[model samples]
Target: MTSAHPTASRQRASAPHAKEHHMRKTVRTSIAAAAAAALLALTACGSSTDSSAPAADGPYTAPAKDITATISVSNWGDPGDKAVYDGVAKRFKEKYPNVTVNNNFTPITTWTEYVNKLVTQAAAGQAPDVINIATEGVELGMSNELFTPLDGFLKNDPEAASLRKDIDPKLLEGFSKDGSTYLMPNTFNTMVIYYNTKMFKAAGIERPSDDWTWDDFLAIAKKLTTGSGANKVYGFAMPYYSFGITPWLYSNGTSMMSADLQTAQLTDPKVKETLGWVRDLVTEHGVSPQPKGADPYQLFPAGKAAMTGAGHFVTGGFAKAGFSDYDILPWPKGTTKSTVFGAGAFAISKTSENPALSWEFIKMLTDQQTQKQWADAGAAVPSTKTAASTPEFLASPKHADEFYNSLSYAKPVAAPRAYNVLDPAFMRAMDEIMSGQDIGSSLEKAEKDVEEALQQ
Candidate 1:
């Protein structure tokens, strides 16, 4: 069932802010862990000159009504997400009375294992009609091999085509292989500072505003980490491999590769500075933790640490814990004002007998009205311009205002499946540097190691 276009597909949401550079960044990774990331980046960068036309060359339209079909979809557990999908499924059933849907859901706590389960189901020809997938999910599944291209349906259905607002170009890049669409975007998260107000007051640091920078962040982290026996708090979190460097890298205007995602070009001075800075956060500054598990939930929510790096997913957990008074501040400005956003999307398996029906259900989950409803309810950030701008999302919720403002300066790296590999490798290199090795030499070796892995 492979598409006529032998080339892989890619989806990206281009924003004005993605064009900006990253600020200070410092990270540590061992060579073994970052290899896959390097390969994924290289694969994504490969052949910017379209290998072929999009897979949507065929003109296919879904049936009008009364089809005896069903779609079983899976996603991370979010009441808001389920509700939106339920609404869409209901609408779909109304529109096509004959369609029956069998929905299979797994809690987010177990989402990391969903791909393995899916692969087994798929290999046994028992894959669902649709699936909710993120970066790890897609690459692990090599979703392009499994999911049918929606460009054909998108070209024919106005309802589907009207989704331009819902789908950001850079996000499309995240799901893309070359330059065509593979997965349909549902929602996205922009990385910003989520600060605890109580902690801020205790630390005697002023509330963060748009004017804050990395230096300001360090000051606040220092203050918040203060205390004596039985009450000592760590300042900032240690640099984690995932989602930690996005704002820093983008703000510093550096990338793991050249513009094309080809050839290891990460040895730039800015990248070195960023990595050194990250290491220093742990060693010299005594601000953040060592780049290990990098779990904010374990640190900040429990009040063992001051500031930590995380996304919208952290908000619900924080509120549930009764850690009142927090805000989403613009990621403290780096060398550049650019920001990094993480996201997820939905796609239908190509092997399914109900491609058209599956798309109808998937699109329904990500529509404008539904996205806003969910985001407002505190599930995930809406990807659309209109939905995100709403007052509910713009106000309160611990740096919510500043978090929203940072979107104007945001961009996301094309998170390909290889990140699952590259992230660990990148983190390992940092491990070596932290162990007291030469910074430039380690980076140069990492550059070689990362590029070599990509060549594989």
Candidate 2:
């Protein structure tokens, strides 16, 4: 998986006072499980305070003369992200010569901390005019009233409509709430299996087809398992985080949360079955590493693991290491073939001093030219299909198209307003189950924890 997972910094920053203050009232009525309660509270709260104020709605008409105003944009900083932002900002400046694009991006190690920081800043009225939000924070941002609905702007701008047509509708749906649009879908990541071609040939196993089933996957893994310890080439590197593990849940037609995002599905028989199946890959089959401290990002590229699941973000690291012998494939099917994804969007904060300027800035950022820059960087699949299809985005890796193609059947990762709170619960259950705990009881306990959190 990508380093998108919470890191040591997240572990140290657990339970900030500010987070408690912001989410205090976010916990709604008990919903039998923490995941359900989190989703319920998040869905019911709407927007917070003055953050839900709508942006000025109309077709954005750029001023004939350049306007001298600054648009403050906030995003979780990543190394490659700043260059893209700077490039887009430079182009926007060509249109508004005097406008200053102040990007207030800070490095963030976890989505939980990023959301907390945004919520705290909004409370103090220091919120940026434009903010980058991901699927995990969409409900939280909405519940906190952090964004203005974008429907009015899109309705009035024909160009915006054209842009929307070029994006995957699933991404737009992921960024919307209550039948209204709140964000301009930007980029996204979908899970896929990365396999080492050299290992497959050495193991004398034929490359598996995209339609291979779970049984086929197990057989392949068994054949690929050949060594032990640091020299061990495990057949697969089991994913240790929620997003990394979700494709399995999805393929089996169950998830940690229900379709409506109002109930916990952790207790479902299918969910339990999926967890057990993965656990057995480590314990019973010994084809995958014990996931506790295994880092597939390192192990896969270093050739310690034969295959691992990750998204487009992995390509950058692989390139840096000059590891070019691998390729991607869709996750092996279980009951069905499916995948999970998470998307990011650029949203105008409701409290922006310059809503019109912010809207114009967003348009520039989502333009094909700007999206192409991001696509070339290879951090994510570009939101625009045009940019995504370009050779720069596809690069030279085999089966790279699988990343974008998965969008056809991908569901957004199950994130709600209380995701920060709920993720720990799910992870704890997974940690125990992967460590050889009974799957059924672990899920039952997770459901109980969910119920308890809601009651609080």
Candidate 3:
């Protein structure tokens, strides 16, 4: 469950802009310390490349209606997630009445912990037959030989083919490496700006347009900042993790790594400029809350902040907070309008004794009907085109479609094999720069750290 995007799985309790709660400091520290060891173990322990699995061939057909099997499906055990999976399980049962599907919900505090736990289960030979992996862990899972390739299944199954056609091709490609597909994408998330409509109206400011520029955003943010001390309302709150930061980097025409994910681009001039601009939002302009003291989720819903960044997962939280007077806007344009996105997919374990049953289960989970149910439940942005465009997903907040529109220019979160080691280092460097360290020196050090991690 390592997030396809950094921080994607960590739900902050009060954040209207996030779905999951925050990871404990202990978890972050443990992940940073154990990353290399975990990577080594992951590389050493599993068979990532299997040659004997059934190949996807001509049209795939399900086994006869009487076929019976039992398979365990593993996923993050969040209540919302469990509910979505429960619904999926219910529908899957209807299609295949005799199959015994065991839902194994593992409660985890962080993406790293989730990955570590899965690896442990895998090593202990207790891994679930079907596992949910995020984009962040897809490469790691593949490296460990943890999943069975779905290429054969996809090619041979008409249902899968139809489903694939509706899914974003980029998502499909993200789960595929060197011509093999490991995960069947279920849902995805994308970054967008969520602004409190009430705050904007109160400040006498216009709502942001889809094509709004960075300067436009800044001007509006400055106007929105008012109040004092405990009553002090900030204009914006920046997201502390890569999931939130990368959109700005991408929009500014820079990225943390090369497309191949093998080279660090932290020292690029555009990146340095982006970092400096972001820092100024806090230190110079005083428009955004400092990361250490701000609770944007609460602040935004309470009318203390004008804007924050998030994905679709935040909708439920915002509703629960009774903050209905808000809407989404596409991220303001820099060099271009861009955002970061990642997908979660169900992958069959290479070691599953019931591969056929597992495959069937995967198909059911990703089928159009289930995806539509996912959309209606507001669990995530559905992966299928038809489902994504359905009224169920597009109705809320009016601009929910921004998630889909942003996809045209969105980049997947970095998922290089070395990401486990590099992720913590990059986050530390970003934190340092944002806290007023010299940007050039901070990025230079981060560049060196990433290079060293790659070597390790």
Q: 1-456 in candidate 1: lDDT tens per residue?
A: 000000000111111111110100111111111222222332333223222212466655666786676667755444445666677777777888888887765433233344345544545546566766554435434432545666666676778766864555666776666555777766666666666667777767777767678888887777666665666678776525435565677777786656545555557888788777777777887776665544545566567676765555445545555665666567777776776665567776655666777777877777876777756665356666667677877665734654445556776543333443455555567677777676778778767765766566
Kindly list the per-residue Cα lDDT of model 2 for residues 1-456, writing each as its tens digit. Answer: 111221100011111121321121122101102222222232234234343323446445544546788778876535566677788788888888988887766544333444455555545556577876566656666755557788867877777888989998888898788888888876777888889999888777777888998999999888888777667788899756777788999999888887766567789999999999999999999998887656676677777889988767667656766778898888889888998887667888766767778888899878998888768775677888998888876775867888789888778877655565566688789989987788888888887776565444
Ranking by lDDT: 3, 2, 1
Worst 10 residues of 2 by lDDT: 7-16
- Could you report the Cα RMSD, in angstroms, for every candidate shown? 8.8, 6.9, 3.5
**lDDT tens string, model 3, 1-456?**
224343233232445434343352224322422432343343445444433346655455666767787778876636666776788888778877998888867554554556576568558656577877677656656766667788878888766778888888878887887899888888777878989888888777877677999999999989988888898888897766666788889999889889888888889999999988888899899999887556556677777788988777667666666668889998898998888887777888776777767888888778887787667765467788888898877888977787677778777887666666667777788889877888889888888988887666
lDDT of 1: 0.56
TM-score of each: 0.74, 0.85, 0.88
Whole-model alpha-carbon lDDT for candidate 3: 0.72
Of 1 and 2, the candidate ranking higher by TM-score: 2
lDDT for 63 in candidate 3 is: 65
TM-score of predicted structure 3 = 0.88
lDDT of each: 0.56, 0.69, 0.72
